[model samples]
Target: MSGWSDSGWGLRMQSWGEKYNQSNLGSPDCVSSSDTISRPTLWAEPSPVVPKGADVTLRCQGQRGRNRFQLWKDGELQEERNTSWHLAEFVLREVDDWRDARSYRCRSGQGPLWSELSDPLALVVMTGDFPKPSIAVSPSPSVLAWTTVTIQCQISSQQSSPDYNFALLEAKSLQVLQLQSLSRSQPYFSLPFVRAEDTGSYGCIYYRKTPPYKGSHPSHTVKLTVSGPLPKPTLWAQPGLVVAQGTNITLWCSRPSLASSEEVTYTLLKTGTWQPLRNQNATDLWTDFSLPSVRPEDTGSYRCTYKDRTASGAQSETSEALELMVTGSLPKPSLSALPGQVVEPGKHVTLQCRQPLQPELWRATFILLKVGSLQPLQSQRPVGTSAVFPLLSVRAQDAGNYTCVYKKTFFHQVSEPSDVLEIWVTDASPKPSLSAWPVSEIASGTNVTLLCQGPPWTTRFVLHKEGSMDIIQDEAKFFLTRVTSKHSGRYSCSYQLGTNGSLWTQHSDPLQLTVKVSSNTLLITLSCVIFLLLCFLLLVCFCHQYIPRAADFRGNSFRRFFCCSCLSQDVCLSHHLEDPKEETLYTEVAKERPKESSVPIDKDVTYAHLNIKNLNERQTNPKETSTEATLYATLSLD
Candidate 1:
């Protein structure tokens, strides 16, 4: 065995061994044999230190024998193969503070068997500062009450044999809340029931669990804010009240949560139906819904909801339902009249209509029509229930039928027409005129009819005859059955008016009706004349004796004699005319000659004296003649 070195020690050992053998052994054989036998030598190379993470190789060479080489690191053997010339290499995979600087050696089995350990291989790995841990919240900034949220911390670089510790801090107060060790590069922390007071900025710090426990920079901060619950809402109505049908109604929705500058949309609900009101962007406390025309079907309970433009969520609450009741429609009406269906012209008539129960909301109108025609005679609206139509002087045109109708305020409903009424009018009749059919030839017992004609409008004709009290009334014409002496009279006719309480017209011009006598009638009249004459003769005879003498009382006896002679000449006339005259004359004579007178004498003497007196007066008036004297003598006869 020999020590390993790079110097020439084996040649010096041969020179000295030859000189010592010549002196000590004193034999030529001893010197020659020692010089012929050889000695072993050893050598090592590249013995300086190497840097960490650098590749290193060791080699061992030996002389004059088969040798084995071995390599060692920090007193521990590394695996290698046997050979006289040996070589080994290694790469440094990791280095720490203590293991970064260490020595390595190589040894041989023969020729002194070992080499001194090599210089230290100092490894200085390039180290830099760790990156800051990144922090983040799970649900961003929105964390509700009693809800869990996650916080995460992550390091940029990882180590092979890494150990990690984590610390959490509030950014506002710098107060630590949690500290723990973890083996992973990224760690997570859970926070629950975050309150308003718990709301703040937060950050995390991470470090490796080594000798120095070097910490990484803090993460970026994040902020969070918590809010409370919203307030309740209210709703109401506009115009504040409801009334009868056809009235306009309005409803309003309001809320206290409405901000002055915020817009709000309102929804009006009725019986599960929803409607949007006007002014959806209004900030006022209420919104309105106008119902221009309301009816019974429109009535219902109502509520509302509101949404603010700036609110995170909609605020809503149900209101007390308001009940609306609307009045119903009016009823149909009825029309009537006084003296109902029958009316007379030239008289007063009244029409009436009865409205429904609500009379204030309705009115009536009357229409008068011709019986069979659609043309209206009159149309009128009366303030009261009854209206009167007066016909002062009625004519045929005034007669007609009439009816009435009633209507509601809105004109949407009307009543059936009233029962029809009829009117009748009348005109005055004319006087009738009469005429004889045959002018000059009417005989007794002849059949004749006195045709009495009146006005065409006359309903009844009345006939009258002069000097008679009987009246014959007929239609238009009058007839006399037989013409007789009794029927010979003036005939006339008149007409009767065909109206209530009407009077008859005046009588017409009279017509004369003459009857001629027959031959038998003429004979009977002559007989009557002869018989009356005979009766007169007998009366004259009886009155003659009673009469006194006329000559004794007469101063103008001749004039008297002539009148008596004229009367005596016609005995028949004397019979009818002389009796009353003779009586009157005798009365005068008897008065002239009283019974006590002395002048009394014989009849002849009285007569002579009268004759002498008459002669004397005749002589004085020569107009007297002898015929006159004879008339005197005849007058003296009783």
Candidate 2:
């Protein structure tokens, strides 16, 4: 009976299996419960869990009835193979607090018969907050009141989200003073008009508020300091003095007690022109501008200003204004003489100086100096345009160089001195007149004296002849020995008051002299006397040799009687006695020969006899005694 009961139980278990098998075979989707076939299945499983920076692994297992299986994680399938189970293992290489707290899962499958999804598991990545953002303030070396300040924050992470927000906090109070959102890892913040109250210790904090919100720690702190305002500036002329018209004037701006590197600019207000006096980079402490050529038109009040740059790119207040007054032009002076001419020495002369157009507006002064001498003859402040120095008796010392100077109403300004005027006094000594001594022709080898006569009492004289000059200190004459023709020509003389006197009179007119040989007139007279005497003696001798004694006897009674008696008595008596007495008487008369010759006389004998007698004796001699005498008388009558 127990065997029959066991058999019945076995029959019942077989019948239940057969029915279960028939059901699986009829449903094709039930793969794992059906016959074993090689096919793939896919499903996911939970990821592995790990601490921060720890390594971890995940596994996916397949059922034995499946021929092939694949591992999956987060709905993504991994590599597959024909095996009873598929396994996937993962190692968490590094994890932070943020990453370790994330969720993970895994799955497995083979073809269409994939396994059910695995349960989800929490992953502890074990990460802390983001590293502190680096923060800095610009103009770190120094800070000033009312200046702009900039704050910069940065994060040194490549993976950080672009939507990170940053906030600057006062480190001492931990109060947020400023906030900013950044699309990049680093961002900058700026604040203008920073004052002393804004000075403090400051830092920055950053965070991301997207799907997963995270915060960052605060950065290192920086301290800020602030200073006071700039000082006031003052302006004035460098050297306080009256400036001449058309001259340059310089003004300076200064802040004696202030120390700053800020720039200074100057502006001069004159004739409606506002000139700029600064350059680029504008940090210079002083500036200068020439007035070029100042005039009365440039006279006005002047001022200066100093500017320091602010955080907002604006200017500061100006400095104090300075005042200046410019004066007018001065007068020009001149010098002249009262008579407007030079005077001779020993005569009265007056020297004068004339002030320019505005004489009454200026104080005039005069000075007269001899050139090359230190002492001035006259110096005075005249009342008007003209000043006179009346010299009672002009002398050598009175001739000199003269000059004039004058000043305007404003004593600080003066006019240029007048051009140098020269006043020369004519010399007093009279010029000596030159003349040759012995007022006749000069001869060679003889001493010649040249007399130079000056005004009665003159002491010194100078003689000039041809090319020669001689000085006669105490005398007024020049003597030359062995005078030659070469020494003959124009000669002149000059006289001075004294030997050493500078004054000298004008030269005298020249005197002319000629030189020749000596004693010509007497020699010519002697030659004429000798010639006349010889002619007279020859006439007397010619008369004596040719004249007849009978011509001579006609003028003398004694010689005439002697001749007649001889002829009548001797010759005629003898002849008559020889004749008869009657004839002898008549014949005697005829025989007497009429007391004259009937024979024609020779002209040579007549001329000779007349010539033989002396002119004085011929008138007294007897006549008619001889035939020659008769011829002579006839010749004389003819």
Candidate 3:
């Protein structure tokens, strides 16, 4: 048997064309009797590659109006059809005989005069078991609606010919989606802007392009799923989705109230990705998709779906979107605590985060991160130079290592992490005891030592002056050397159990210190008192020696008078000393004409005495006797 390309088929077509031209004697609708009809197109329905027992339709396409079509195989007419339509189709039944693998052609005309033979259409029958071609989809098999999807059919390089024909068929209906005669350069079938209607299982087949066209077995089916149909599955992340770089997390995909016996599989989907990010088979209703050490590139919106393992392969709707953020793009911010990192319970503490002061960082959100937590503890925009997070009435559980970062609204860019700031919250019970050495009241130019006593486990001590931000740390003693008036204030002290521990004992009672006169001034005041005492003693001795009448007088009367005079002088001197404006001494001498004649007037001796007088007033005494003659003298030391 000869094929369509054999010389026999060419001669048969040539003779028919000559005879048809000769017999076209009178045709009213024909433009001219010598005019020859145009050659038609012949092609196989579905594809040239067919299964062993499958039937295929051969179509001859030509001009309209009672077109006469003839289908030939191996240069012999197999069938003919006369129809008013532009094309005629003939069914080839049970193409199982490998011996009948031959070329096919068709022709169409008005009648006696026929058009030239159409191009040869090869018939491929699956007789020998040929290896199946591998099929794969670009990006992914599961696609979003209105996105382009590509199906690639791949065979071995040895099997790849110049004109290999590839056909993509839907598995359910066994309908060909696309058929292309391709070279090695173009081997894939593309479905542009696919929709929900395009969702189904698909397979591909390949065949030789020439006569005796051998066909390969169908490839494994690939399920094409378009999202948004079926019931949506629930998706959540374990340990949270927002994570730092290198953090591991799991995405859970589950169908609500799913039957325990139903086999299910889960798929993880990320936005902007055409294929499923991950797949997992589950014996139960849910499955976990673990992403270990995720990077910045992994940050995106994610969703999940659950599909039954049944024959229908029904897939559930996509879950609500969850955002995965991997921060570390900008620069880490600084974190600090107000008051101190170690705080007493019942006290309010503020955590301040200072972000980089870049022009693009304005209004950037600051996030407070805890070491063991997957989510941010708090977030805020900077109000001033730094973002402040207040922890009111802080409890013991609030103690932990924390960091901070800033995120810009532009592209959601995040900064690197700041240094960790650990907050310690304790009861600060069993208050320490504070005491001052010597005295709380210290004069200037003296050392004031404060001692703090705490539990036996204490390793460090701290002294805090009231209304002061300066903190003085020491072992047990805090010394203020050469303290001035500025150091005179209320002070308190606390102790720490360990050298590096953030916990602290409650502050001790405040000790107030009063600083007085300087050491030099105190010395001067003592010298003045000593000098005054010496002057008084010298005056008393001089008066006793100068009075010679004291030995002559046998009676106690004169001695008493002298003693009384001396006592009165003491009172006058004390009065004069109180005058701050002037320093003056007044002397009065009483000369007695000797109540006894033996008491001669010691004219060679002078008597020194003190007289009491008011400077603002002067008076003259008229009663004057030799026994009470008074002489007055004044001395002034300015």
Best by TM-score: 3
Put down candidate 2 lDDT per residue, 50-122, tens digits, no spaces. Answer: 2245554444344555444444433455445565434444444554545433333344455676655443333
Candidate 2 C-alpha RMSD relative to the actual structure? 49.2
TM-score of structure candidate 2: 0.20
Estimate the lDDT of model 2: 0.50
Which runs of model 2 end up more than 4 angstroms from their true locations? 1-350, 354-381, 389-638
TM-scores, one per candidate: 0.19, 0.20, 0.31
Clashes of 1: 3
Predicted structure with the largest lDDT when compared to the true one: 3
Question: Best to worst by TM-score, what's the order?
Answer: 3, 2, 1
TM-score between candidate 3 and the true structure:
0.31
Comparing 1 and 2 by TM-score, which wins?
2
The regions of model 3 sitting more than 4 angstroms off are 1-257, 272-275, 309-322, 381-385, 409-412, 428-638
Comparing 1 and 3 by lDDT, which wins? 3
**Order the candidates by lDDT, highest first — what do you get?**
3, 2, 1
